[model samples]
Target: MINADARWLRQARSRLRDADPVLARLIDDRPDFDPRAWMAQLPPMDLFGALLFQVAGQQLSVPATRRTLARIEELFDGRLPSAAELLNVEAGQLRAAGLSWRKVGTLRELAERIADGRIDPDGLSRLPDDEVIAELTAIPGIGPWTVQGALLIALRREDVVLPGDLALRKAVKAAYQLDHLPAEPEVLAIAEKWRPYRSLATSYLFSAAIEFSAAIEPAGAPTDAPLRERSTMAATRAGKGRPR
Candidate 1:
């Protein structure tokens, strides 16, 4: 759990509410919002496992990602595997667990780095966001989006945002009433106003996007409707590594 200062939390809320009326309304509508609450329900993951989950989830729906992860955990006695444990597992077994060839290679590479001390989860935690990104992205298949997810879910950084995320762009458009989805640069510029709390702000935006999606999903659509039917919801929910 993150040790948040009470004063910082209060200040972030005040500043965010003051900076944007839309977000202010969101804050008002959801009084019980705790951005970090989603983390409570996730299976505990170390930094490597968090990165693995992020990679596993990319471009996939929340439920699909969970299914894949469940299969993976089943391979390791119903627990998220450590780097060493992952290394011990055969590539074929991981492939059987629904991991793509690319994802499997990425995981193996990540395991190797962790095992060799080239990528230290503990050390990465202490570095600035840019350094963390640079170091992690050095590994294959670890892109900016993956690192951003890690920054939020694993390191619990305060100011980071995932401008590269399509869901976030859609959320900005819907929540801010933009005619078109904001581009990456536009998202970054808008996020600047929510400085020092982008992570928290993102959480609220994601929640708002999710509520908006649920309100709009077809009345009789299957509860297990594929994620494509609700792209925004999947993306927003997946960004936090959780189901809506």
Candidate 2:
């Protein structure tokens, strides 16, 4: 994973502080927050692995996603498969590992394209964000939200946001004190002020939402589920990758 330079992070924080009051308070309240801390729990992922993560996470909860990923890793001796390796595996193998038929097909198609040189994972990193989105979104089952999550997790793009994320929409409503949950467009409109540091801003809002959810949940209720859900929402929806 990429690490933002200390100076760069400071600058991003300062910019967000001036850009919006809610984020300003959020940033101030957590003086030593590490926005990327959640990633530590995830396995090391290449572009293909990240895409697999996004695909497996579709419409599933965080616990379910992790379980599926664990089974997939078990198939490869405890590691995410390379594109070639994935293509070598039968579709039924992935299905047995808990992936939906649609996800299995999507992953196989993506792996084939990458393995055959139709899609260049290395080259994608060098392209502008929009160009990368354009190229990847052309694939079946891969949408803007999926590509956006890959941009953040795989490429570490700084300015990306997931307006389509349901948890994020709820977080925006809570953070901004909106009476109703904001739609994708409204989320985008409000996030306009967070340009250039949106990923970081998004992390803050996600953290806040998770905390609030945990606080209100019954004492015996499962806590890690919600935490993981919110933490990975940038990559995945309500409990799945952003509801597409």
Candidate 3:
């Protein structure tokens, strides 16, 4: 399995390199980059836990998200709660952990669906990417972006790209020397060359953005307001829960 994965990655890398010169340089520059290395630092989470992470991150900075996640974990003994366990707790408890009422409601609804066999977390991996997105997005507050993050972090799907991600847009701007931040459709059009390796290509762009941010910012200086807004979400998707 490991060999097969390696072979597959090599093929993907070659294909991506041939399809776009920009991505070729990005891939060449980081020959040893492990796209999923950041996952090691996080606690083991199932599909529900992954969704919880994604949902918790919506519209919150990295530090705030981490704090919220920590508070939620403290309620359940320092780990994210399972779908059943989450449903067992009161919604007030989740709110107290810094989750908004909307997030709390979304999570509860998701947990209830899973608990009642309306959605099978385990079966999700067997379905195609679009199917998973469609199934999850049917629940309120669970949009394509949230499901896309789950696809990368939980399912490890190979071809996913988050065109709507602000950090990714910024990354694309910097990497491609665009005059302005590209919209979702523009990002998708640029990413067309990435094809089956969009996920891998995304990892490279995220790494570049993080590196560029660090290079430009001085120590102890506040991040630019716009970039700081979604940096945590991008970083979390990049790897560990911290900034990318």
Candidate 4:
């Protein structure tokens, strides 16, 4: 299993302190930034389940997707099913377990590939970023956005960002008060300044999105917030990729 208590956080922040002049001033402005406490609150999870979660969550709203995931646990008698067990289940049962027919097909294809050794889910933990993307994208319905997200949540890899994610791009545009949502390459170019601590930066951007959305809501609106059209949890206990 990968170590969740990666020391990258401390090192990255230190580098940022010395490397970026403005960040150095910002750190001085708020001397008590606590990276450890922030990280400690993020739940730990295995890479494989995260990948499954990512695939399962694509294009689903957060609450609806969670209900479906809970359905999967219920399907396997209150636990996440093993890969082999997943293969043995009837496709209809999986659909009943709460996936759409398309998602059911996507999951089965992924499982079959892994089980047959055409793709190695376990091997993902050890692969580099580009290799992980290359390997994972070989599966049906898996794409760069999916892989970029898995890399962040599952591996807890630093500096990886899903530039194509609409939520994140929108978050950045709103947070930074940019004139327009940046394109993918522009997103990458901007995120480069956040290197090594980009994961932490991502956390802030997501927080900023929630903050911005709240700021725009009617003052007397209900606390539950308006239902999102197709918003998946950006951060997952494991995979849970950004919903397109």
Writing each residue's lDDT as its tens digit, candidate 1 over 132-232 gives 98988887777877777778877889998877665566678888888876777898999988887898888788777665663223221111112222232
Candidate 3 has its poorest 10 consecutive residues by lDDT at 215-224
Question: Residue 229 of candidate 3: its Cα lDDT?
Answer: 26
The top-ranked prediction according to TM-score is: 3
Per-model TM values vs. the true structure? 0.86, 0.87, 0.88, 0.76
- Number of clashing pairs per prediction, in order: 0, 5, 1, 2
* Order of the predicted models by lDDT, top scorer first: 3, 2, 1, 4
Computed on alpha carbons, the lDDT of every model, listed in order, comes to 0.74, 0.76, 0.79, 0.60
* Clash pairs (backbone) in predicted model 2: 236-241, 236-242, 237-240, 237-241, 237-242
2 or 3, which is superior by TM-score? 3
Task: List, residue by residue over 145-201, the lDDT tens digit for candidate 2.
Answer: 777778888898999887776667778888888888787789999999999899999
Give a tens-digit lDDT track for model 4, residues 1-244: 4354545555666776666554554446545544334333333435555566666666665655566777887777766666677889999988886677876777788778778888776677788898988887776667777666667766878767666665666676775567886776787787888886776666555444454563222121111111221124443221333221
Candidate 2 global TM-score = 0.87
Question: Candidates sorted by TM-score, descending order?
Answer: 3, 2, 1, 4
Model 4 misses residue 209 by how many Å?
A: 1.8
Q: Candidate 2: misplaced stretches above 4 Å?
A: 1-4, 214-231, 234-244
